[model samples]
Target: MTIKAVVFDFGGVLIDWSPEYVYRQLIPDEAERRWFLTHVCAMDWVVRQDGGQPIAEGTAELIAKFPEHEVLIRAFYERWQEMIGGVLDEGAATVEKLDAAGVPLFGLTNWSAETFPYAWETFPILRRFKDIVVSGRVKLVKPDPAIFHEMASRIEPHLPGIEPHEIVFIDDNRKNADAAAALGWHGVHHTSAAATEARLRELGLPV
Candidate 1:
């Protein structure tokens, strides 16, 4: 089927999101870093926060779990702004090209609501997309079919004549790309913007 919409994952695709960068910046001491990562940097805490749990509550729960590191935990949660950065210019340009071609653009990202505005401000190109389905806003993170379905529902309505298969989903993570592919959408495991643009051209999409 011909491509209709091009859905992009924000983190790792548009913007570089590395937890290690944050870890290194915040927890400079090697011994302290190990402890914080093992005990305090809880995935559940991140999930709960993304699921719309109050930040204070998530921080408090984490603090309660690891009382010794409560100060660092609070600092990490509060100073999230120091971690995130902007999207690369070349990638942003590619997205702009796709948008200009009348290809419906959308974002399906596992991004925190608290940090999205920071990302948006940093990457001005994000404003061009027709729709943005964030996991934090929807409370459904990807690798889960429901998040993909949620995105599909929102995108399908916008492209009235197009089927779900016509949407091309791109992400840096193989699992996410594969999940999208399994759902009958075109999925690209992003390596470089040049390669991705070539793939779009192969699909007869005006990149």
Candidate 2:
């Protein structure tokens, strides 16, 4: 099938965001930071916020569960902006290339509604995409077929009757890439900017 649009997963692919950035400075000890992140401010816990749980509510609930770590828990959301490392140059360049080539661009990201505004305001490259489907906005995260379906529905207004096979999805997580592939779309597991761009070219995209 001829590809008609490019769907990008913003966090790992185009933007460099990791909780470690915030914790590293606060918890200088590597082991302690790992322990805190793994047992307390875990990925699962963070995903809940990405799925639409209010940031304040999530933070309060976490502090309640680990009263001793109140300060740490507060820091998680308090210093959330530090987690965004900024737009990745090489990766974002690919988006620019595609856009300049006249390819339709869109974004699908698992980001907290409460925090995404910071990045949205900070990065100009993000604004290039014609449309974006944010997990927090819709309360559905990636790897869940529902989120991809939501993306498809949103893409309809721009590319009418577009099929899954006609879109290429780029995600850094293998699970997300596989999930989209399972749904019949061409999913590229982005390991690096060079690799992803190579794969996109192989898929017949101008970039």
Clashing residue pairs in candidate 2 are none
TM-score of each: 0.88, 0.98
The models' CA-based lDDT, in order, is 0.81, 0.93
CA lDDT for candidate 1: 0.81
Worst lDDT run of 10 residues, candidate 1, spans: 81-90
Error of 1 at 40 (Å): 2.7
Give the runs in model 1 whose Cα sits over 4 Å from its true position.
29-35, 42-44
TM-score of 2: 0.98
Q: Which 10 successive residues of model 2 have the least lDDT summed?
A: 78-87
Best by TM-score: 2
RMSD of candidate 1 to the true fold?
2.2
Query: Which is the leading candidate under lDDT?
Result: 2
Residue-level lDDT tens digits of model 1 in 129-203: 889998888888877889999998898778876776788999988888999999988989998899989988998
Q: After superposition, how far is residue 115 of candidate 1 from its true place, in Å?
A: 2.8
